[model samples]
Target: MAMVCEGLVVDLRKLEELSCLEGRGMASHYYPPCPEADRTFGLIDHTDPGILTVLVQDNIGGLQVKSLRDECWVDVKPIPGALVVNVGDLL
Candidate 1:
């Protein structure tokens, strides 16, 4: 299970904690920082670790998913009355 927010402040300590205690540092993985080439549109990414993912956005469209190697970022522009789903690593 997980909680998500595009601009909400987070306390990492509140995470379910999949690993042992470790000092804080830049996360190797991230929901790509506000794309340098993207702004003034709407969103850039939507991510969270949960059994399933749900997104609710305004008219502003910009949600995207990055490709492997990050050579490109695919725009997953949101659509009305649609739900994008993903499977979590419940392993």
Candidate 2:
């Protein structure tokens, strides 16, 4: 994950000081089967407060991202054994 973050920072042409970042944290989410899935959200839309977020999603698809340009909800399809990297607000 550290390598991924470093690569992203480099690709963005951002400051290279992020390579020295040492803080680490993790979280796991579980959503039960809901018959009325449309009426409720598994997770609310929000941005990570840290510099980056690496997500590992299950086969169940519910993740969405709000488009900054159009304010539309975009579905994030899950890929097996893949990680989704997101740039957080702090970056």
Candidate 3:
């Protein structure tokens, strides 16, 4: 995850004293099919609250990323055997 924050001010490179290994966790989510897909959202638009997030998308992808270049929420089309690395607020 620290690699995701490379060149940033809060780069977490030297974490020998931070007990980072003991403070780690993981999660999984499942979203059932929504009949009204346009009107509903499994998760609302939000920023990552952690240092970094490694996301593995399935074939039925619905991921989106806020594009800084265009200043828009762009749909992230998933590719097979790929991972999305999200840099978060905590850096």
Candidate 4:
């Protein structure tokens, strides 16, 4: 899930089109950046809108979420079997 967010940002760097992003390269198609708005990086430094985002990592993790107002990343500490679910919208 983290990589998906990072990939979107990276894709924005390569091509400005969000629609061009292929879900085949992603495990979760539900984590598209700016799903509604036709914009790139519009979701910068903000919390996720999804109720629960399931992330997949290859040994090392690759997700980075930040505070929108304060402008800082919320560092995730190492914890065994930790499934951090950032709640935003209603479940």
Cα lDDT, all candidates: 0.48, 0.71, 0.70, 0.46
Where model 1 places Cα greater than 4 Å from the true spot, the runs are: 1-47
Judge candidate 4 against the unseen true structure and give its global Cα lDDT, from 0 to 1. Answer: 0.46
- Total clashing pairs in model 4: 0
Q: If scored against the real structure, what TM-score would every candidate get?
A: 0.38, 0.64, 0.69, 0.32
Better of 1 and 2 by TM-score: 2
Candidate ranking under TM-score, highest first, comes to: 3, 2, 1, 4
Off by over 4 Å in 2: 1-22
State the TM-score for model 2.
0.64
Alpha carbon deviation, residue 21, candidate 3 (Å): 4.5
Better of 1 and 2 by lDDT: 2
Residue-wise lDDT of candidate 2 within 31-62, one digit each (tens)? 76688877874556677898778777778767
Cα-based lDDT at residue 15, candidate 4: 30
- Per-residue CA lDDT of model 3 for 1-41, tens digit only, reads 46533455454654433544457767777676677888975
Candidate 3's C-alpha runs over 4 A off are 1-13, 18-22
Query: Which candidate has the top score in TM-score?
Result: 3
Screening candidate 1 with a backbone cut-off below 3 angstroms (N, C-alpha, C), the clashing residue pairs are: none
Count of steric clashes across candidates, in order: 0, 0, 0, 0
Residue 24 error, candidate 1, Å: 26
